[model samples]
Target: MKHLLTIFKYALLLALSGVLMWYAVRGQDLSTIGHYIRSANYFWLGITMFLSVLGYFSRAYRWKMQLTASHQTVSYWNVYHAMMVGYLANIVLPRMGEVIRCSVLRRTSGVPVEVSLGTVITERVIDVLVLALLLGVVLMLEFNKFWAFIESLFVDKYDSLAANRDVLLSVAGIAVLLAFVFGYLLLRNLDKLRENALFVKVIAFVKGLLAGVFSIRKMENKSLFLFHTGFTWLVYYLMDYLAFMCFPETYSLDMKAGLAVLTFGAFGMAAPVSGGIGVFHVLVQSTLLVYGISKEAGIAYALVVHGAQTMLVVLMGGISFIVSAIHSGKPAAQKQMSVSR
Candidate 1:
């Protein structure tokens, strides 16, 4: 049931992105788009694909570091499948990859599903903190532009963010209080129920997963994790820049422009915007306009870049899925990993 809803979610994102692209290109005819594509450097597309795959490898390697505490190391190929399959799920939902990919791993690699989820939550915290720090630094350098860009999103006459601060604060306080109450009740209920052996196993699995997240406790070699983080984001930035180059209109934008677009795209992915659907196009075009690009051209560049990257993610994810299926069929290997599990 959750999986079906997740599929619906991704489908919605695909639809929204399609509409945004249509609206973006509505001004110019297909011939202009065709010319743009024809003139694009296909070699860069190839390079972009290579870097994206590298990003997957980095994720796999980093996750292995996170899992080292169990004294178990799965092959990079296994991790790649997990990462890719997870990504495929996320493209449809805002963050449903945790469930989709972890579900697959639990079945094939004997990783506990609950633990898989806990590790994902841990991963999200790390990712969000890194993103916040990077965004803060970037925005600090371009505060006027960034703030003004934000203001542009609001209707000029009716909005009063500052004036409503008190009300917002009161509302937020109430929500937090309610959350605490509900969480306490939920935990008490779980404590009351101890009838099922399966449930106890699930609880232990979750503990193991949290342990995986904490496995980085041994800082004897932080270099590997740092290297993987650097490599992963390097690919992300390069992919953003290369996508920008696909359109002549954006090629002249400075490095700041690329970074800004990448940051905005990351934010868009966090929204319940249907796999980042319409939100991604809107964010990219808005960021490009801040850098002196025309609205039409900015829209075009955003659409092209968004389309290409989406294609790249899906293509690679499909390959990973196929590879994992073949890997799962080997009974001997399955038994081998079963012991580790």
Candidate 2:
């Protein structure tokens, strides 16, 4: 039943991606998009992909720093392999890669899953903060260009929410009351809960997670970690900026435009869809539209840029999976041989 539910979940997500994809390309001329894609400067894209590789390495090293601060002595390659494998998994399954990567690290480095998961959560929180910061910066700088588009996205929803404000407030109040009551009950029963095996395990896991999350405070080279973080985002921005040169329509776009793409595109990728397939394309296309680029050309650029990055992940990730798998099997194979002897 659990397996069935997992399958259903992925299937539903996949269907949603398909629907969004159709909506994105619905009125566009495929041949025009194809023409734009074909005419793009492949050399710039190649450079972008190379920078993407650098970004991946920097990100893995950053993660290694986090793990080291947590006192888990995982090797750099192991972390890289696990991270790449996780990226590969995400191409097929949205958000599942986090747990899968943590599991991989546990298998390879003997790191506790809950600890790694906590680090993952910390990483996500930091990323969200950075993205939000960038989004704010872009919106502030390009208010005239982006305000209408941004407003269009939220206005309808905001209106609906305002219309139901009273009911929503009542529901929210009830939720808070129930949460408080539940917390009170849990506190009253804390001693009995501590006696339960499941509760004990949960407590242990939470402790490990907290340890991992706080590991950043114990990092030895905070400056280096910050450098890596900045470098990774720089690479991300360059990927968008350089990709602009790939097509004539976007070639004349400036640094601020690239920043806008990086900000909005990151949001698109953060959406809960496989590889951010449909959502990224749509958001990127819409964003480019704000810059006076036609939807056809914008989507064409999105397709090539996203396609190249996706290919890179698949290629690098496939190799990482194979290498990690072989290395992981060695210990078991040696153990079996020892048993036979």
lDDT of each: 0.73, 0.92
Tens digits of lDDT, candidate 1, 169-241: 8999999999999999868888665566888876787787777566667535788787887788778888888
Give the Å error, residue 278, model 2.
0.4
User: Residue 227 lDDT in model 1?
Assistant: 84
What ranges in model 1 sit over 4 Å off? 1-34, 154-191, 194-202, 273-275, 329-341
Candidate 2 regions with alpha-carbon error over 4 angstroms: 329-341
lDDT of 1 at 22: 69
Superposed on all Cα atoms, model 2 deviates from the true structure by an RMSD in Å of 2.3
lDDT, residue 46, candidate 2: 99
**Which residue pairs in candidate 2 have backbone atoms (N, alpha carbon, C) closer than 3 angstroms, thus clashing?**
none
Worst 10 residues of 2 by lDDT: 326-335
Give Cα distance to truth, residue 112, candidate 2, Å: 0.7
Please report the TM-score between candidate 1 and the true structure.
0.81
How well does candidate 2 score on lDDT at residue 105? Answer: 83
